[model samples]
Target chain A: MIWLPLVGLAIGFQIYWLPGLSLPSSVAAYLSLATLAGLDSIFGGIRAGIEGKFHDDIFFSGFVVNTLLAAALAYLGDQIGVDLFLAAVVALGGRIFLNLSLIRRYLLTETRLRWRREG
Target chain B: MSTIASPPSRGKGWVFQVTALCIVLGMLLALSLRTQRRAVSEGIPNRWPALRAEFINLKQQNASLQKDLAEYKERYEELLRKQATGQAATLGLESVLQEAKMLAGQIAVHGPGIIVTLHDSPKRDVNETRPEVIENYIVHDYDIRAVVNELFAAGAEAISVNGQRLIATSSIRCVGPVILVNSVQVAAPYVIKAIGKPDVLQKALELPGGAADGLFLLDMIEVKQQPDITVPAYSGSMRFYWAKPLPQPKEKSR
Candidate 1:
């Protein structure tokens, strides 16, 4: 968990601080969908961690597979002249919202239980 | 969070891997955003007004710079005349100056050469038949490059299209309906002026299987040779940041 925030910062610096380094416009759609999928996985992982159900294998594999599948779907769509990345975006976005709601509920219950014990 | 039954050491490893994956995700997000921003900013829709303003600014700067260069060149020539002792040295200096002027497009060139004019065909009505052929009616960037290439191969010393002098770095492109030469927008009828031996330039363009012949077969084009023609000096910057002259090998003393 500690390494997570540090790694995030390093990646941020690598992107925003580097000059004359840019991805091609054609690949933006694919990268965007992959990013969305990655976001969903990270949130899901956090929720699972908080609930004491986080599995090392599942979390790591899910992260890699989700991103790769999203990007692959986008590329396939490009080759076929269809907007398939939008499908990936919708699926990942729905999952992210669902994960957020669960996270919220767990936090609320945990806080209530702790307060009751203190009282 | 730590209350799970899994071993603490194994849990830490998972956390590290997941975190590393998150970092990769973050980098991808940043790159996607930057690429999108660049695409928008560099796209034709957003750059038109900005480029127009920049073109005007550069034109003004070019004029002022040319004036300053002429003044300095005159001063330098005067100094050279006063310092030189021999006629041979003076003649050599004059020849070098002429060579430099030609290469830099600094001096207005006048010689017997050819003038080639290209005109885009008049647009047709909405219901015209053979609609696919309409694309062939208009002049393209490649057509201009072809003609320019032929003129240079025919030994044209200087050339200009619609008053924009052609230089090594000059780019001719088509943006929508108009042609852009050295970043200046020009519309048809396009007039190309080349300074060389009149007969040779004319013959090169009139070659049976040449760029000019191809244009004539497809569209309306006019080629004329004159006794004298003038091509204006190049008005753009010639500064090169990346290209460098190769170092010469030192010769062993005999």
Candidate 2:
């Protein structure tokens, strides 16, 4: 069941990779920032699911809004001569790390408790 | 410990949504990574500043090289101009030298003029064969000099007597029976080749009271208007022991 998302991720990567889709270099910075935001949201969702606070509406809306908002903010910053792309990367990277740590802690705690009871 | 634990079953639907979103994320990540890799390989992102600096350096080098090329082209044209003027001056000097050579009679000349032949008269006294009387019938050095003076006054540019070309230092005189022209001995039937207008030279010698009139009466002179006559170059060496050229007057030195 856990491997289902990983398989889906592989499937999506192949969908773009097999077709050899290309984007302009000018948009690369924003796309990378958006990807970072999406990763952060995924980790946050996983952590919420572990804590029993997962909401389908929030997860779906967050993913869409965060991806679009990150790319748009970076583009706007570029037009206005600001380094908002770096800011977005730093902010989203921090969240991803935090969410990843929390998920790790939750999974480790669950596994240990289950093992102790069984033993 | 139980408070931090996962519930037995919250919502299984979140996993499906998360999977779907992960797929989207995977696609975005693939596209971004591909684009970034391409930008890096193209050397547009990280190496932009260094490449720009090298480009500016190359542009400056090209500008300086172009300036040097322009200067060299200007110098080449200037040298060509100087060479042209120098050649012109050389040509002018060459022509002046040619004219001076002609005037000095140091070069051979040929043109239309008359040839006067002065020999001992063919007529002889049949009744009295006296040597002095025969001498009166023969041509003299004065007769030859008179004929030459007449030719010169008639605009003869060049003249030669018996192959001896006459120059400004030339003299026609007799040493006994031999006549010396330019100090070179010449014999009778003196064929005087004069380069000038043939008709004018002939007419001047044939005038009733001309310098050669007496020789003409005795049949010692024969003036023929030839279409072509050749005057040889002077063969004698000329040198001045005490003559020197005078400097130009200051007022006339324009």
Candidate 3:
């Protein structure tokens, strides 16, 4: 079931891999920031699921809103001559790492408890 | 907060949404990677240093070439200046040569002057039998020489005797019955053409005690002023067998 998302990611990459497909450098920067925001939301969703706190509505809304908000903030920063892209990257990156670590600990404890029960 | 009642269903629902978001992330990643790769392949970042160095080298070469062009232009102007002076010198030499040729009687000349004709006296004493008195009635070589000398003293520019031009080495002498001028035999009526101021030449000949006075009294000479006269060039060639030209002395520096 976890592999389903990885398979979907591969499918999406192939779908965009048509010949002559390209994005301008300015748009590429925003896209990369939005991708980071998407990854952060996915990891946060995973952490919530492991804690039995996952909500379908919240997960879907967070993915859509975070991607748009990150890209929009970065573009706004560029218009205002500020490096808000860097700020967005730092904030989203820290969240991704924190969520990943929490997911890892949760998975590790679950496996440990399952092992003790089996023994 | 409204939490889903079924934990199993909630877990299942989150996976679906996460999977959908991951697909979108993948597309963004692919597009960003493609754009960056294209930017690198365009060579703006990769070849900038090499292009700048080449541009500098070409600029230096252009400067050196311009310098060479300026130098060649200066040299060309210098040669033109030298040629102009050389042409002037050639023109000066040509004029000098022409004047020397005229002085040497190697060319024909014409100007305003007088003509003097001498002939033996037509009047004679029928009974006078003395040879000296008879000789006086005929013109002599001395008479012609005297007339020529007088013309020279009166500033005659050129002189010819009966079409024979007289140069520096000319001689007038009696050869038996005929007279020789420039070694060419000539007969009288002797016509002496002198190129000078016509009035001055005629006055010199008509002076009371001048060289032509005896001939005038005897009716052996006739003088007439002409507006134009021509003197022929010397026909004979001259050669120097013993007299060689002296080397020109170098000019002293001031």
Candidate that would win on lDDT: 3
Q: Roughly what TM-score does model 1 have, to 2 decimal places? A: 0.42
Instruction: Using DockQ as the measure, name the better of candidate 1 and candidate 3.
Output: 3
lDDT of 3 by residue, B80-109 (tens): 999999999899889989999999999999
Candidate 1 wrongly placed segments (more than 4 Å): A1-119, B1-90, B122-131, B249-254
Model 3's i-RMS, to one decimal, reads 5.3
lDDT of 2 by residue, B1-254 (tens): 24333333476667787899989988988898888887677766622233456776888999999999999999999999999999998998899898998899999988898888988776756676888888878878888888888889999999999999889989999888788888888888899999998888888998998898878788888878888778889888979889887895677631
TM-score against native, each model: 0.42, 0.55, 0.54
Report the TM-score measured on chain A for model 2.
Answer: 0.96
Worst 10 contiguous positions by lDDT, candidate 2 chain B: B1-10
Question: DockQ, per-model, please?
Answer: 0.15, 0.27, 0.24
Clashing pairs in 2: none
For all candidates in order, the CA lDDT equals 0.78, 0.84, 0.85
- How far residue A39's Cα lies from its native spot in candidate 1, in Å, is 99
Q: Which candidate number maximizes TM-score?
A: 2
